[model samples]
Target: MTTGTPPPTAPKRSRARTFVPLAIAAWAVLEIWLLTLVADVAGGFTVLLLLLGGIVLGAVVTKAAGRRAFRNLTETLQQMPGRPGATAAPAAPAGGSKGNGFLMLAGLLLIIPGMISDVAGLLLLVPPVRAVLGRYTQRSLDRRMRSAAPGSFSDVFQQARMHRPDGKVVQGEVIRETDPQQGPSRNENPRPPLTP
Candidate 1:
């Protein structure tokens, strides 16, 4: 009579959940200080040009890589079990809605400005990570089904009015009061069946 474990909660992989903002802020201050130093030593034009080039390069790289990775993820998901299938899904790319979401989010994080985030995003985009996430979700579903209460139609009718959490209770009652006309009314005699 053991209850099953609840599904694991969504991982708090959000950037807002951590002290990452402080680190990012520190880096930003350092960048500002470096910019000032460069402005004083070298021509400001050189610094401006370098910054613009970096921005362009970052944008282009993320766009190209994210597009390719997302396509792979989409194809994998389209071929998962319970999906409309023509050919079998490849073994390398795993598939599921959750897997796809994780990959997409990972890609997005990678696009944002940080090396650690990019690496983490790349790992999520990989096929192996998708497989792991999918397997865990499946096992969770299986455990839930196994632990579900088993019941039948008879059990349903027996406890029609009551809520049965375990689905194994037969707890209800049927009051059998005689009809007023068939039995004597309260105002009528309560002796034997009145003999005329």
Candidate 2:
């Protein structure tokens, strides 16, 4: 009889799958409400100009962030102590990718043409906010890589082994012969006598 605690049960509904749709719906409602309020105060023409400006700014920021990320990644790789093509462990924090991702997300939000989304995007562009977000993103990625399956891309860089208590064990013997042309001796297996 086993004395260990029972395994945790999976939830009937996936929170992420459900939460994403709900969050998007909420964002849309909030965006529309904010836009209506802004239009009432600032006039429709001003709101339209603001949206166009935001689009242009978002495009510029996205391009610059992408270029910066590529530059940082190249520099990091060049500084690693290993032969070319060798998969050396990441010498520097993966802040470049994370920052790029957040920046791209912010750009997308700004392009959505909603005052609420634009404000959120502008906040994301702040250096301190990006730094905090980058750290969070890095930790999340590390956690996912740790939990990934064997033979996956994550496994290629990981040096640790995964334990399996129920793994199979095979028993076998290997015999090697130096001479390729020699046959087995008669004592090992005698052949039938020749016909008279």
| Most accurate candidate by lDDT | 2
**lDDT by residue for model 1 over 1-196, one digit each (tens)?**
9799998999777776576888888866766777778778887887677555544544564566567667777887776666777356455653333455565566566555443454566676677887898799889977765665657444454456466545564545544456867885667655444233
Candidates' C-alpha lDDT:
0.63, 0.79
TM-score between candidate 2 and the true structure: 0.59
The lDDT, on a scale of 0 to 1, for candidate 2 is 0.79
User: Model 2, 1-196: lDDT tens per residue?
Assistant: 8799889999789899989999999988998898788889999898899989899988988888889888887877676656586456756555455568889888888888898889888999998998998888889999999899988988865533344344434455445444557776545654454443
Worst 10 residues of 2 by lDDT: 159-168
Error of 1 at 96 (Å): 19
